[model samples]
Target: MRVTPQPVRRQVEERLREAIITSRFMPGEHLSDRMLGDVFGVSRGVIREAVRLLEAEGLIKVVPNRGPFVAFLSAAEATQVYEVRAVLEALAGQGFAERASTEEIAELREVFEELAATRPGTDRMVLLNLKRRFYGVMLRGCRNAYVARMLDQLLNRNSQLRATTLSDPKRLPQTIAEIRRIVEAIERRDPGAAWAACREHVHQAAQVALRILNQQARDEAAQGLEVALD
Candidate 1:
């Protein structure tokens, strides 16, 4: 049987969504409908439909008169996202440790090994993809549909924030150590330890991300004040 082709609008949406998540489309950058239509070789209507889909996913925003722009995560939004992610990841870790088969655990370990082997100065995208693969194994082995679904919903936004958090050279070694702890706990089939390790990793990442977001907000505020004084 022949497979059905995906709709043009959906294809465009996925391409744009990946671009946004990978930071090829920076937050707050304007997205021109005509330009996108030309780039994607699609009609303006198709571009509009793709933009609407991304907007619903919180990856794009359409202003009344200014057209569409990539969505930016405010500090408050980032904090809430991380808070939810921490709890969900802990649940996933617990489920994976308690229920995953020996083969599944081995699979997760294999992915973790790849992630650990990534050099400290590896390309950001390469590291991010490895991390995604590691998490994919855990999510699949967790055997909780809701946990997987919730995490999936947060992934794009997580990538958006991660561009900042993962840029700090110091965070690479710390992140690897944290992930190693989680993998070690899972290897022992210790659900409680796995849950704790996963939660702690998210917590530390949230702290670093929040610090950068807060500083950026302060700098923007200062710039606005200077403009007002002028």
Candidate 2:
């Protein structure tokens, strides 16, 4: 059997998507096709194709004359994303609790333990990777193909918003505790409790993210007011 090579366009698109998701290319920052082509060692056409893919993923926006820029999420959009995520995640948790085998639960537990062992001052990237792995296990064990697919599409924006939420020094412990609660419910095979735990975790995280966004908006408004008065 011949092995199929991954498409160059898809490879470029994944790199660009990861860059945007990791905040390497910050939201609203312009992406130059020539510069990106140089950096990726690809042609302008390839870069453009990759960028259009990212645009479809909602990680980039193309302006007619201005080219493509990283997508920015407003507080309202973030709230809506998290609200939908809460429902989907709760469903996943419930499904996992109801269906996951003993071996699968053990695998998820191991991931959770690794996550819990992460120190407060550990690198954010490390924590993010562990969190991703934990959720990967959950998605696999949950046995809901449609829910997995839907959540996969939202993962990039979810990563962007999570960076903001997890940046708060006070939130790390709370996040750990929330995950612990969910895991405990799953371990007990309590679908209702697991669903509630998952929803509550997302709800609390949304509140933190919304608070930060509101504060930033207020600061921007005050600055504009000062400029007007002057």
Candidate 3:
């Protein structure tokens, strides 16, 4: 039996999980216990516990006799997840618009202001964190626990797909603008406008992901043909 601190294991696991979701660790990349332990300065047992947590979250896979690898979503699965997320977030946006107070709306607006003012040189992790906070504020306006939980799960999954889309220069400005529109609608207490903005935003993101997937498939096919010719 390997001895390790539970807190260290939990922290390392959470950080690694975020890295995987952000594509810092690409899909199908092997996660070696020793390597991760060294990187995190933790015991192998701690790494194991952390890996187990990520596996439970469905963000990583631990195969029997094989190894742990970053999880990948199939094309169909990706589409399904995004579709469900669109509906869930739209509902949450509507609920937030309906229930948010003036102070709450002001707080969200402040967050948007900060997001907008941030420099372009900001890192992906920082941008991702800001995005999470922005949605978190909106979700808090939704008073229902069940809806909040479901929305959180959907968005958590979305962070994985979001990394690829972030590679596009056009997506950043477009996303910021779309989020600004949602914030504006929420501030106005217009549930219809807020819902519309949220749905349209998510649909646009899904379109971006589909485009990336198509490009990836094309690249793979080209590589395969080149290998066959050689």
What ranges in model 3 sit over 4 Å off? 1-6, 118-122
Q: Which candidate is the best by TM-score?
A: 2
Backbone clashes in model 2, listed as residue pairs: none
- How well does model 3 score by local distance difference test? 0.82
When 2 and 3 are scored with lDDT, the better candidate is: 2
> What is the overall TM-score of model 2 with all chains considered together?
0.93
Listed in order, each prediction's TM-score against the native is 0.92, 0.93, 0.86
lDDT of 2 by residue, 69-103 (tens): 99887889888888899999999999999999999
Stronger candidate by TM-score (1 vs 2): 2
lDDT over C-alpha atoms for residue 170 of model 1: 88
Residues 112-174 of candidate 1: C-alpha lDDT, one tens digit per residue:
888778765678887777778888889999999999988877877769677556656788888
lDDT of each: 0.88, 0.87, 0.82
Worst 10 residues of 3 by lDDT: 160-169
Local accuracy of candidate 3 as per-residue lDDT tens digits, 1-230: 99876677678977897777677788889999988987889998889898987787677888889889987766677798889988888998899999987888888888888778765556766677777888788888867677788878767666766755654567878888999999989888899999999999999999988777777778989999999999
If both were scored by lDDT, which would come out higher, candidate 1 or candidate 3? 1
lDDT of 1: 0.88
By lDDT: ranked, best first: 1, 2, 3
* Candidate whose lDDT is highest: 1
